[model samples]
Target chain A: MNDTRLIRVVDDDPELRRSLGWMLGGAGLAAELYTSAEQFLERDDLHRSGCVLVDVRMPHMDGLELQRRIRRRGSQLPVVVMSGHADVPTAVHAMEEGALSFLEKPFTKDELLGVLGRALQRADELVQREAAHRADLARIADLTPRELEVMRLVVGGELTKRIAQQLGISERTVDKHRERILAKTGAESWAGLTLLAARLELVSGQPVEALATA
Target chain B: MSTGRDQRQTEPGSVERTPAFPSDAFDHLVSQIDDVFWLYDCQRERVDYVSPAYDRVWGRSAARLLADPLDGLNNAVVAEHREEVRRAFLAGLESGRFEAKYRIRLPDGSERWIHDRGFPIRDPQGRVVHFAGVARDFTERKLTQDRLRESEAFLRATLDALPAHIAIVDPQGVILAVNRSWRQFAECNGLAAPDHAVGLNYLKVCDDAVGPDAAVAREVARGMRGVLDGSQSELMVSYPCDSPDERRWFELRVARFETNRCPLLVAIHLDVTARRRAEEQAVRQQAELAHVARVATIGEMAAGIAHELNQPLSAIANYAEGCLDRVGDDRRPRSDLVDALVHIRNLAQSSGAIIRRLRSAARKSEPRRSSICLNAAVRETVELVRYELETDGVVLEMQLADHLPVVQGDAVQIQQVLLNLLLNAQSAVRHREQPRLTIATRSGKNDVRVSVVDNGPGFGAVAPDRMFESFYSSKPDGLGLGLAISRSIVEAHGGSIWAERVDGCSFFHFTVPYSRPDIASGPPPGVSETGRRLGPAQHKEATA
Candidate 1:
């Protein structure tokens, strides 16, 4: 699956891009190429698990601004920004926006390949986390009405007895509902479930009344 | 012709038209006197004693004057001065003293000026009994006085109206006089009453000049002292006298105003700030133009420079990756790794070359000229851009002449021109696998010409004559200063640069003449541009 995933190389120089693609291919990574950032955007490469490798000082639609646009669009695609000596400061500053790493040129092939690999790995991790969040959200929807009320209270940090009191149920009955919710959602711990909900932007760490509508 | 007694017959009550005495000696003295001596008796109120001198002084006979002294004298006095002479006479008549000056028309039809003085003779009771007076002709002294006064007035008017500030200082260093401009300058500088400066020592005034102009004042004082001591006949110096806000320059000139009686020094100041400012403005404008060209050229080539540097870097990366791959497999020969290492080394060297070129291009350095071969300059410039030319897949060819004579020029400036022309040729042929650029040098009897010829779309639809204008650009990103600065550099070397278009070829040609012994030994003052000798064809090349 890792071999099947692609790395997109965007550069102004055709020969350099081809050489980089050949280098990456030797590392058991697939390579897709674009001559410029505009080409990369037009080809819809941002929606893929493959990361974008950009040289910082391109002629048009240079890499730093492209990194900003990609992040603004909320794409999970990671970018590896590289630049020559004159453009190193801007490339390094672009790292703040979740660039995989800033690489300086005349980098060894291993360094380029390593940063590209990290960018792809970040994209893969993001995609998997997004799928997990969606699965967790689906599991929350599968809860019974009573279980939903109990889980919201539990994630809200109420004790089992307090949860039962809030739901007007017995303590044992609240415990039974918590067990069912945890089993169905596959949450390893109560705090873990809240953190997952926060990551999905579904609920606050301290769940409030708004969770009913969610 | 008629005298005292005969005249009294018309008057009577005149016992003394004279004194009824004929002393021959006294009569002779009175007749010869230049003054008109007269006596009038108050009691008689009519007759008067008269001297024969009346005819010589008033051009009238004593009988005519004595008959009607007031009317006769009024006629003798010029008509315009009649009332003035009469008023003075009447005033003295009461005071018992008389003094008056008046113009008279003589019987000879000529003009004469007269002076009249009279005294009253009083009795013991202090009452005037007789009046006596002398009237003298003073025309000669009056003429000389009038001429001197008119000449002085003319000199004053001419000096006051001049634009130059003029001051006359005495040998003792006191200012004797100053013209209008000198007083106006003092007034503008808060020295309100100019009379104070007139008597003030000029050397003392020079001591008060402060700040940037202190030196100017000191120098002026030295020169003025030289003029004062008679050691130097003249002082001529120009100096800046600036206020805090604006700059001003003045020329100070001092020369001896020699006279047989008393020698004086004449000092003059003329403002020359406008001409100085104009010259300084021209120098500043040329520097700004050169700076703009340098900055715009670099800005336009930024992307190209980045691309150039990146190629070597990417090649280095690709080579290392190939070496690693070969090592991991253990199937490739040791020679493969060595080849990869060598390629990496060359790529690194190319990147270094690009950086050095960019630094030199961006450095704002004054042109440093030295002895250089045209072929060597061409070779060094090509080396700087060789990687870019090769990467762009352009076929570069050169036919540098052998045994080429050295030219006097700035190596960096010449290299800059060659680089600009080469880049122009490179960009002209976009997407071509073989964009042929050829550089050739040929020696003539007195000069060497270098040409950059490219087989690209030759100056398409654009007139070749308009190629070197500062803001004319064919490329979208070009600032168009490249060719203009190139032409300026070439011309600064006393050569000529031009463009030609023929048969789908764009050629840029420039020539530098061999340094001549006469010209090289005698470079102009402030002319650091040493090696330039204008060829006969340079003017034609420019017009073309």
Candidate 2:
């Protein structure tokens, strides 16, 4: 079997926990068990590669709260909330609070395996995105302050002269700064530079420069 | 005698007049020497003196009157006064100088009122003297009497006009006087004539009306005296008078008058018979209504009572069945097993009897004439609704009187009365905050009364008397039939039933004639007089 990914089980019922562990193990995935959200919080290993299957009801802390706590801890743990009695309203709430999926209890072994597998796949994609985002931020960090400012103005579609006036510099100086920003950001054109910034979450609002900042 | 004007005339005319020596002249003027210088005699013992006044009064010669016989002189007087004049003359003759007043007959036989003065003549020197008197007539004085006649007529008219039966009786209660109206009243009521009543003792009429009872007669006499004495202003008493067959009230008022020396009694009568009859009728109706109320309450509880009886029956059946089953086991000796089986059979018989009672109560179709087995009847009634018992999750218990005498009535009616009671009880406790139905039958002196009690919300503060009326039910969909029919049945069987809340449980009880019937063979063998065969109380315990 490929030891490519892991599935974490969070439940208080020992029987449910064991069942899911065996079920997840049989499905070509490694499984980690946490008796409660509090226990999982105290774990030495973060298990960044797996999807956490959290039971919705427990004696103390419940699944939805656990999901929020995991995200707060910066675990990026993809949570799949499983409820014994799944009602639409509650499932909708779980999904709203960033649950990868909601599975009702007494589910078939296959249903659990299928949902867990999908959850793990989604987690892998998210992990890859996080890694890319980190690399992107590092590369964006190497730009000089003036080069960064030139990059914003160039993506905004301002001509060299306008850029020089806006920045209080010569047009030639503005053109020189924009060329280095493009080289560092690896943007072949102004639109390409905006697209990269969007992919990296570099701005808060919608398409400010891309739609014509000038 | 002269008038004042005459005196003045005489005084003025007396100038130089001889005056005629008036005193001597007046005497001399009336004395006449030739008027009869002789004495006059007439008839036997009759004599007359020659007086100028007599001559004037008689207008006859004195000697001629004296020559008439004394007998003729008496005859000559008015027929009405002859004897009276003779008697007065004789009285005067017996005494000296006799004087007399008489009515005299004149020569023409005309009557005259005369005053005569006479004296007896003496022989010489104050010897006996013949009577001589001057007589004067007073006819004009007698003619002036007129007012006295009118007054006598007015008094008679006033007494005749009174309206009441006014009678003036003597102190002895005799009727001395009665008005016209009193006479008419006496005639109408078959009394004697008013005149006949005058001297009759009033007690004669009272004795006739009140009969001859000495006590009644004495009371009547006392009442009469009380009226006469003024101590009692009026005597009022009721006696059979106009209404001879019934007592009639009479108010007699008697007043005493000094003039008649009698008490006047006035009687007024009135009748009050109808009012008395009406009062008696109202009292009778109240008593009947009270009796019906008592009977109705017992009747309505019949169903609950049946359920109550059913509990014990079911218990007996179970207990007996257990004994029967155990009796066949080899572990027990044959005789012991037979005894147990017999005992079980006896219990079944007692329960059967109970069921029969219940059937009577439940069906209530026909009245059975016999002493009722109340406990058994209650049990049987409970058996009839065994399905209800199980479904309601209610357990019934019975504490029946052991030696209940058979009450006198129809057993079936008693049972139905009880059945209605039991059904009501079961319904009452259905959703009870705590559900239970208890039936108890005890021997009352003349009856075997039973009750069905429930631990549920009680009658909710309704008066028990109103509770048994028809259409009075607490259940939501209840038609209020059970109690009404139960009441009717109980009344029909001459028994009673009622409902009451005790310790939060509804109790319904009724009694039939409690004496047991002939067992065809005395309670099927093993049953004892105390109903020992019915066994001890046993109930199937359940959470419900």
Candidate 3:
């Protein structure tokens, strides 16, 4: 799994880039090298499941800037910022910008490997979560509009009669829609259906209240 | 005997009688005159006649003088004047004229200066028979003449004592008198006139001057004429007059004065070469101090420099580590291991180069002149400050022109100038939202200009030229010597430096000539044609 995962190394120094590639390759991992952050950002597969190791001080776009750009593009790829010196403020800034880790230069082979391993592991977990969320989103997409309304109200902790009244429908019809939601989402029970609805709300990036109002 | 002589002298138609008046009448006139009339009988060796005024003039009785004429004359003569008197008497007797001015002591211990004149009376056979003359007291007139001569000697001595070459000129600019110093200077400079060019028209000389000093001489002439014509009371001019072996400066001062209502000019030329040299030395010492201060400022950038050094070192370590890892694995290709090793070597070399550049800059040495490429210098200097700018999030842009010509200057000093400008720009934009600094180079007609521009609060209240003044600081802790030193360094290399505000940016621009106008063509001493130190191989090649 680690070998399949790509570790993108972005730095302005050519020797550092080449050495990083070799080191990662020797450690039984796949590595890609880029001379600058801009070059890395130009890739169409930026949203792919992988981790990026970027120097904190690159020409034009820095490591923190690259992290922000990735996040803005809705990519959950983990970033590890490398600094030539042990600058606390820059490290803190990188962390605040959602970097997975900060590495000072002259780091030992073990240190680099350790940081990259953790970043890749985090990248894997993020990829898995994204997949699960997409699966939930697709599953939630299948239900009828009435079924979704009933599910949102159910997840909102509203009783069946209140939900039926809010929807201007009979309680028996609301019960029938809930049953369909559970069937479509593959939930074995009412609790399972509610959990599925929560997952859908988390993935769809919409608050449960908004969904209920809708 | 005296009665008989008087009776003969008074006889009508006497041989010694006056043609128009009687002998007795001349005797009466001589007795009444204040001068003493006497007659000396050379043949008889005796005094023949003496007027009554002799008693009052010589303070001796006539009878006493007649008794011993030699005793009377010798006794009254002062000891110092006796020999001169005697010598004059004997020589005059032989030469048929006796004239002596000598001091005589009276019997009362008073002194008198006497003027005596005598004529030879010849007999019919042309043999001298007697001598007659008048003696007068003229002591007061002699004293006045003596004082006047003493005063003239004192004035001449004073003029010669002064070191400044001085000359007194008339209203028409004719040099009347020149002091000893002036004469000596004229002689040294090969002026042929023995009187130190006196009687020469000074204004014409100035107007006719040739060579490099001609213009300055003409200016001096104008100033002097102003003083002479009463347009100005005095005029002073300082100018360079270099000799073949050494450089020199002189100051000329001209003032008008009157002596006996005659207008005159006193022109003084003072050698101020020492003062000029001292001033130049002070400026040079300040430059040296500024250099030392610049090295100290570099110390303040230690963190950034270390960061720059760390990059290559870290790369070396990474390469070495990778090479070691691969060497232990039998499956690793030999070519791959060799590649890593080569990279490690190259990284180490680059790190060494960085340290070398730093040491070269920090070392305190005499500034060297050479042809240096501005682009290369800019690139090298940027290496030292890149880390700091990056850490501060400053946006640095370099727009160096392609094929920019090399300039003549000290590489380290030029770098220092660029470093100062860069650091100042960085500090100016440190607090801004987007700190942007741009360093650009351009080639002009005869020089290359470099500019460091910063997007920050422009020089609001401070004048652009005032910013380059020494000790003029806007920062709280700044010594304010950076731009000042930069200006001096650039100027010393025959260039110019200035600062200005344009479009909300503080721009510092300096230019260095492609070849220094003062320096001759070819490489400076101790440097090769390639702008490198003359090593043994290069020296041999150069000689060959």
Which candidate order results from sorting by TM-score in descending order? 3, 1, 2
- Report how far off residue B95 is in candidate 3 (Å): 13
For DockQ, candidate 1 versus 3, the one ahead is: 3
| Candidate 1 off by > 4 Å | A1-214, B1-53, B106-110, B121-129, B194-196, B208-210, B243-246, B259-261, B279-544
**Candidate 3 C-alpha lDDT tens digits along A56-169:** 888578889989988998888889999987899999999998999999987888999898889988988987887887776767767666676677778778899999889898
Evaluated at residue B4, the lDDT of candidate 1 is 45
lDDT of 3 by residue, B1-544 (tens): 1334433353222444557888788778877898877788887777778888888888888898799977656899888889998889889789878899998888999988899987766665567777777788788888777878777878788889887888898988788988988877766665535466777777776766554445555666777888878987787665555555776666677899988968899988777778767765765575587678678779878877877787778777777777776788887679998888888888888889889888877867665666699999999888878877877789999999999998877888889889888988988998899999999999999899999999989888999899888988788888888888888878766789998888888899999888554232233222222221111111121223
In order of lDDT, best first, we have 3, 1, 2
Each prediction's TM-score versus the true structure: 0.38, 0.29, 0.56
- In model 1, residue pairs whose N, Cα or C atoms come closer than 3 Å (at least 3 residues apart or on different chains), thus clashing, are B493-B532, B494-B532
What docking class should model 3 receive? acceptable
Off by over 4 Å in 2: A1-4, A44-47, A74-76, A201-214, B1-544
What pairs collide in candidate 3? Answer: none
Instruction: Name model 3 segments beyond 4 Å from true.
Output: A130-214, B1-79, B84-292, B329-335, B364-383, B386-415, B429-457, B469-471, B476-481, B484-544
